[model samples]
Target: MNELKISILGTGDMGGAIATALSRRTRHSLRLRGAQPGSTSALRLIDALGVTEASKEDFLASDIVFVVVPAASIEEAAAFLNGYQGIVVAVSVSGSVGRDGLPSSAERIATALPEATVVSAFTSIWSNVIREPGTSGKTSVFVSSDDDNAKEVVSRLATELGFEPINGGALSMALYAEVMGMFAVRLAMDSGYGRTISFHAFNAG
Candidate 1:
């Protein structure tokens, strides 16, 4: 694959981990941005990873952008990408219902940024696993989007990052993906399995 310019929007755990993984595992040109301007975490990751820190224009110019900010900040994140017309990979899960009668976070982002092709991905994988992919065998990452080409691009990215990407159908499937992510979180926190676990599909047929 040709080197694609990718940008990550948050500098929190998930965002930092993703930037680290892409820098170490792939040759994609990465741009890092924070949910807030002049974020310390973003600067730390940029210094540590040697990736470019994104300006608003840089962020909008990326071929693929990952919004890894918290669910509560979805509107702000969407507003930042108001006119962007590229693939947007949404990693946060929001429970609020959108105007389209869906509670999927990706759908909410899509509703906000009508020009951008929204793809739901990486919502299930824990930040630690992204930071250290070799700790286990290939982990499954459910990729869902209304656009096939956009989904393929993200799936290729997942593969490059040492993950197995499962096609979770259209954008509506994001609701179930979010639910599955929450279930995993519950298992990790309440069931004593910890955050080291990941979900995979078994082909019993």
Candidate 2:
């Protein structure tokens, strides 16, 4: 795969973890940007990861932009990328309903950004697990999108990050992915497996 320009929005745990993993594993040019531009945490994360900070224009121009902000902030994040005409990997899973009664965060982003190809991924995997994929074998990442090309791009990214990307069907499947994520969290916490645990599908042929 070619070296792609990638921007990760939000400088929190999930965003920072993804940036760190991609920097160490792939040749993609990474740019980190916080939901609030020029935030101190964003700068600190950039310095810590040894990655460049992204400007608004840089963020929008990236080939693949990862929206790693909180579920409640999906609208704000989507509004920021209003005119971006690139692939947007929506990492937020808002359990709440969206406009037009869309159930998944990815669909909400797609609805907001009509021009951008919205792909839902990385919603189930925890940030700690993303930073250390080898610890859990090849963890499965469910990728769902209406655009096949966009889904393939995200799947390639997942593979590059030492993950097994599962084709979770169309964008509608993202609803299930979101629910699975919630269930995973519950299972981990309640089962005493800890947050580092991940799920894998075994094909019994």
Highest TM-score scorer = 1
Please provide, for model 1 over 1-205, each residue's C-alpha lDDT reduced to its tens digit, 9 standing for 90 to 100: 7899999999889999999999999999999889677789999998999987888898788899999988889998899888999999999965443334647888889999999999999988888899887655788999999899999999999999989999989998988887777777878999988887788875889
Question: Any runs in candidate 2 off by more than 4 Å, and if so which?
Answer: 95-102
Please give each candidate's TM-score.
Answer: 0.94, 0.93
Candidate 2 lDDT by residue in tens digits, 19-42: 899999999999988867788878
lDDT of 2: 0.86
- Give per-residue lDDT, candidate 1, residue 146: 89
Local error of candidate 1 at residue 39 (angstroms): 0.7
Q: Per-model C-alpha lDDT, please?
A: 0.88, 0.86
Residue 102's lDDT in candidate 1: 49
Per-residue lDDT, model 2, residue 30, is: 93
At residue 53, candidate 1 shows an lDDT of 87
User: Which pairs of residues collide in model 2?
Assistant: none
Which runs of model 1 end up more than 4 angstroms from their true locations? 95-102
Candidate 2 has its poorest 10 consecutive residues by lDDT at 94-103
